[model samples]
Target chain A: MSSSTKHSKWRYVLLGVTAWLAAFMIPQAAHAEYGDVVINNYADAAGIRPAVFPHWFHRIRFRCKVCHADLGFQFKAGGNKIDMAKIIDGKFCGACHNGEVAWSVENCAMCHSGVPGTPTHFHGSTVQSLIAPAYKPLEGK
Target chain B: MKNKIILTSALALVISGPAFSADGVSAEEVTASAATPEPVVVAQVAGANVFNRNLKKVKVKNAPPPEDGIHDPENEGTYVLQPPLEAYQGLPTSPYGNYVDWVKAIDEKKLQPRWDRIDSSEEAFVMDLDVLREVKASVPDVIFPHRQHTEWLACSNCHPAIFIPQKGANQINMSGILLGQKCGVCHGKVSFPITTKSCKKCHSQPKPEDWTPPLSEATLKNPWR
Candidate 1:
């Protein structure tokens, strides 16, 4: 083959190799898909239930800027330095949980009503009916 | 012509000498040259601050060790500022776009659940049929703490869906979770941050065999309550 033709062929080969290498080296950038905010931190440590913070429910009722921007919640779980004292003092959850806006702090059973892992007595009745109607004994018996 | 050919060969050898020659230069010289690169050698001899540029912006001046000998950053009251819990600002059409906005708007609606009012109750913690079925199908029941979670989160955190006021109505399943539904919602993301093979981390019980506690027991205990 002529030198010019050979050189052109070599150029094509080099271009192919370069393209393959670039494709192999570059990772596909994955975009974040919206979903739940799982909280695996301190759940077992704090003896609390596996905390699953579902984002879908709250979004329908409120806006993103409310809690995250205004209340100062960290995007990541365990990111917030939350303690009971801070909450009772009206920080974090306490800011709104002060009774007027949401459930009153006096209503301990609303959250702390049942044991961890054990269904709350208040809500248990409904769940029991759906899953195990046979498990329920006669009222007085 | 012969001389020209020889010269060309010699030039090529010199250009590619390092590739072919096992000992192109003295080992000691190579080692010394590598150890004393231009930047490091220049800084050492000048006695100038290496991180001067970074220090100026943050105002963090390095000082001699304290007499007490404690080098903890916490003691110096210079802890790293945590990233705020703001909604991710990346995607315009996030499945949780509205949800992220809702959490941000928590302070405005005044709908944030009180830490005290948070249902840390064992009852609330109880895994519903959907959650229990999913756990039992794959592994053991995940010992969840409802009240303890409430302390850390707002009611808007997992209301109306992962859980509903009406029990047994919420459709939580392994499929949905794996698809980022229900508990899987945050397990792999912002919460425990699920992994491909993190079964034991969640499903495993609190027994000693496979137990690994991340936080201190003191922190776990409900001191205030």
Candidate 2:
């Protein structure tokens, strides 16, 4: 192969790699999608991956009030103060996750499954994304 | 000397690297546990079901018209059928229940949900009665409207099983609702969800400071008289 042809091929490879990297970065800047909460409160210090809560998955099976009202999950992200010890103790997340209603804590990978070094808060969280479209008063109408 | 030992161990963590095991724990966690007792290194699974990464499992939502399981690949007409995503583009949207806002659609007269499926001779029984539920909380009291519910449901839907026809017979509370009872039977599942944003939708009537329970129909009517 001619030296110029080899150089042009290498240039194209470099351009392709740079474009791929840029494509990945744009989504990262948006910083997480709606209905996902990355809980890193204690995971990094303990060397475990951050727990990524999928609100979408749970919402599909169960109702909003099930967790929020009955199980006592606060509306704000990072507000519940979830810990592995508490989960094992059969509180908060353990209510359903005690090897019966859902998967138990021993199945650690499912909940504590996130890329290392991820921050505690997820941007574009559910509450912020789905704020009341303004209260429509229907009573006494 | 201790600093040197700690530094060397920290470096060892990097050198040993993360373990990819069938079980989701890292080999690093098992070995490093003696030194750092609570350390738990998770096996890194790329494209894990995090951040709705379940979508990564299936590249496209629906296969192209030719390969879609429902469509007959041999037929040309199957290829020309409207794509599902494109067919739903312009309608009003809600965050839940498949993202379509049927309530607003009805208000705008875009789509009518029901074309009187009941026998045309028998007019739909539409009740306009409102039952006030006086709550002890400082928040506004709840007003259950029969008009809205009866429009979609027959009286038999909730009568003997879910709720007895007589007042104060069936007990109700927030916890019961959360546990998929009474109002929650439909509200959180199919209808609008019981979210913080939607609290006022049900809890609308302002409670009176000197509120008293209303009398029963039997006590007031005295049918014989």
Candidate 3:
């Protein structure tokens, strides 16, 4: 093959590779895509139904920083040791569930709403990127 | 002929060096390419299709498209149609581009939901400052009090949409926050305004003397409600 012809062909191949890499790195977001976290840490053992955390509902109104960064929530399900005491102490769930900020955490079944036979609350398509364990809580806390 | 082969090999190495050195490409592919000649490297470049095929393992479960009625007619019968607008499309070109203006519009239009709290999540959160400090931030690291905001707002107020819910996902800085990106989303207008002069409000430490450690016998027994 001629030198310039060979070079141009390689250039086309390079361009194609670059285009493929870009698409692979950044996948399109699914419309109304969301994921759920089933927190079984202490809920089931405590005689309460395991709490199911929804991603889509919360994401629309508030930014993730409020809970994950400012509020200090771990990204993984059952990652944070959330308990009733902590909630009542005005920590974790308590921070908001207190009567002033949100509905008082008086009801046990609010988050533990997912008892057996109750259909889990589901919404939005599942986002592949978000389904991964993204929240890495600060270390040495 | 030997020099031509060497030149081709050199070019091949030059192209593939980055993918190998960065350790992002597969190790198996790297090892295979390393033992082969220039033409083999070219074939390996072609094999990037295989790499992409592996990445395609991320399955996007098809959900019904919104009934917005903007889908292309050609794909009406198919589920592969694109949304009306891409996510990264810029905000409306109106003067109300900033947070304050947008909030005003929301209030005027009664766009704000009466129930700010979502039906779920009884727990609030408190992210520690230690993580920020560890990054060698010049200023005292800011503390996020989740309950303070969660009372009024819902989770979608900020999340994977605005600030990714993951640590190290968003590049937050005072300058950007001041310009109304991160904390600036509300702090200035809706929430408390930030002052560059005063650092203690958000940066205050858990008073060493008054701090009751978690897992304390009393806390473990029944923390003060």
Score each candidate by Cα lDDT.
Answer: 0.42, 0.57, 0.47
For residues A38-57, write the lDDT of model 3, one tens digit per residue: 45667656665556454433
lDDT of 2 by residue, B109-167 (tens): 45433323222244435688999887766778999888666544566566776788887
lDDT tens digits, residue span A84-113, model 2: 888888777897799877767776766665
All DockQ scores: 0.02, 0.02, 0.04
Better of 1 and 3 by lDDT: 3
Docking class of 3: incorrect
lDDT of 3 by residue, B27-103 (tens): 55544555454653334565555445343432333222332111112232223323313321332322211112223
CA error at residue B208 for candidate 1, angstroms:
17
lDDT of 2 at B32: 54
Q: What TM-score would every model get versus the actual structure?
A: 0.25, 0.36, 0.28
Q: Give candidate 2's iRMS in Å, 1 decimal.
A: 15.6
lDDT of 1 by residue, B1-225 (tens): 445645555565578667646666644454444444465343354465445644212111111111111111222221221111333233122122222333223324333432233332212222322233233242555655553344335556677535685645766665656545677645544333344345554565534455453565677796974
After TM-score superposition, the amount by which residue A90's alpha carbon in candidate 1 deviates from its true location, in angstroms, is 20
Best by TM-score: 2
Candidate 1 accuracy as TM-score: 0.25
